[model samples]
Target chain A: MVKALVFDAYGTLFDVHSVREKCNEWFPEQGEAISQTWREKQLNYFFLRQLMERYEPFDQVTREALRYACKANDVTLRDEAEEELMEAYLNLDLFEEVEEVLSQLNDKKLVVFSNGSPVMIDPLIDRSDISGYIDDVLSADGVKQYKPVPAAYYYAQQELGIEKEDILFMSSNPWDISGAASFGFRTAWINRNGLPKEELDIQPEVEYENLKGLLEWRD
Target chain B: MVKALVFDAYGTLFDVHSVREKCNEWFPEQGEAISQTWREKQLNYFFLRQLMERYEPFDQVTREALRYACKANDVTLRDEAEEELMEAYLNLDLFEEVEEVLSQLNDKKLVVFSNGSPVMIDPLIDRSDISGYIDDVLSADGVKQYKPVPAAYYYAQQELGIEKEDILFMSSNPWDISGAASFGFRTAWINRNGLPKEELDIQPEVEYENLKGLLEWRD
Candidate 1:
């Protein structure tokens, strides 16, 4: 039952919401609104780009969404603010328990399958001091699709030389978990929002409250 | 050339978020969060279903997402609460100016192209007192595609029996406006959020703060 535990980067193993903290420091007037808009727009861009069939780097897409949201919310962040936001992205905080949970899963193959570029993810993983425990880092750029794309899961499987069934895909986004399930991979949806998955035709094989639950989960 | 004016139903013509007012009476503890999560998951379901080549009535999708979000936020509602929410959806408040603006364009073929089901939308139009001004109500259920899907525009055009070039698609969602534009229809994006459209290599021919701008728009 032990195979690869493929962890999704944003909102799964990492404290993606902490990106808000960094924004608050820069644009105090409308920081919270700008940050919320940025997150919403970033996800919107992901799906929009997928539908449009035009792939762009996650960093570029994230930056574009942040810039527009700042403007819309009447938060004027100069070029330096933009750079600071991008730096925040590269330096995203790891969830408080991510390192310990990941270490427990280290006995099995541990891989990072993310929509982010290697450049963006590498620094975070390195900063977490858990890079040594990771077996591989797979980027969506190679597959030309973001999470919730079947190809994204397939890319990680193909790159790791494992069957879909051998990879236990994990993500906080229900759609990403749905995609993995559809692709015939066993999945543990990290429902950190404490929500149920949207009623899709396929359901996840396992649902965990967070990585801690997932750490104790054995198939 | 006055040919046709199309409007997005949610947030543009109808005040969909006004439903939040009733949330306090039902799930007072997490009313605001419940409402926000419902809207977010509703869009998530639409995009995921469209990407997966599956379709469901927006009401079913809406109810499912609502239930998920409510549970996630620890808000428990009685069955009557569901009925109340559904009723709220059908009884949306139109902006003070929406009726007057639609009246101006009524002489020139006004239509509603919505992401709602006919069941969900038709009732709203009937209750909102603006049904008399609309010539047609087109829903994604007709095409098995949601807004931002290229097929939504094509299906609307075919249903309207109008050439793509002659139809003006209007929406507050940039993704939808961009999709309609890519589908070869002219679009006027209602930038109600004051945000620029992300760089998707697609652009709306017109941009406006509200539908009133469209009444005076001459092209």
Candidate 2:
């Protein structure tokens, strides 16, 4: 009886690592490392900021994370290179199955609920092939809070005008699933990496390898 | 003018990685990897739990983090090995200069304020050589909130009966320093590794290579 499917954007639908090519162009032989560290620190910055009650938009956090990633990887991030790398986030590649699955699930309301700022996520969605399949895009920025914070998910529930139990929230990030599930949404953990589940006491109600598995929920 | 000095226990006064030897004995070459991931995941769990309003005690969080770290590194963690590794946390070695610095700053009230539960941090403090130098130990467990969250620092301040400005909070972790600084405490970042500063908008009042720098602040 789920009426809407809310998907996490960055890792669940978009390939954040797609920026590796641009990063590799700037930092030869270090693109993969920079991208990996950048992604890790990006999430860390969000969690840290949320805990400290210091909320910065995702774009700025992404840039700061890039700067740290570059320094940690021993590469200098030239100003222009940084701008181009940041640009790359706006045009991230969609996961191989995203468009097909979204199209199939179009009868059910499909929404993007993410920690990504609208300035970043809007363009990303519009540029992607699945944009037409999405009914709404919600950003945590609207609430000035990040995911895993109850307020962020509550904001989404309120905006969609849907009951939490009837909204299936999907995220590749375990922490996000923990948050959404704890906030009362029926959760589907899109564990793309097949990695171990986080040891957090809360568990997602369902687990899937990718978005394709999400098609099972479409009514 | 500072009347009290509050310190972060793990990685500030105590070497959290000192558990490497025990980890190595249990898992051989994977010890270093396990310890590093264990520490990183340990902090991540605290931040995640704090954001989700799921407040598990630090000891429980530490144990869960260890379980994930072992699974992540592709090592099998036996039940007995898990208990032994958890035991190592109680007996972590202090940073080389911690005892000397605390001894030198005897005129100042020295306190250990940590995310650790009292059950964990109490024995850790009592067993350490600097036990005689410490005046009080305050734990975030009392507030059921982790550091970087304002409540945790406020708990420390109330317990010590000191004004925020007159308390110099020291930690090797930048996020902890940011939290303490934002809460109005004078902060000293013990940048033992000389890593680049995090891009959080806040900055510590002072930066030092190690505990020895605390001696400089004494009246």
Q: In DockQ terms, which candidate is top?
A: 2
In model 2, the clashing pairs are: none
Q: Give the worst 10-residue stretch by lDDT in candidate 1 chain B.
A: B193-202
Across residues B98-150, which tens digit of lDDT does each residue of candidate 2 receive? 88888888877989999999989999999999999999999999989999999
Candidate 2 residues A1-219, lDDT tens each?
898899999999999999999998998889999999999999989988898888999999999999999998888888999999999999999999989988888788899999999999999999889989999999999999999899999999999999999999999988899999999999999999998988977899889999888766543
Model 2 segments more than 4 A misplaced: none
Model 1 off-target regions past 4 Å? Answer: A18-25, A28-34, A126-128, A193-202, B21-34, B193-201
TM-score of chain B of each: 0.95, 0.97
lDDT of 2 at A204: 93
- Candidate 1: lDDT of A109? 87
Task: Find the 10 residues in a row with the least total lDDT in model 2 chain B.
Answer: B210-219
Q: Local error of candidate 2 at B186, Å?
A: 0.6
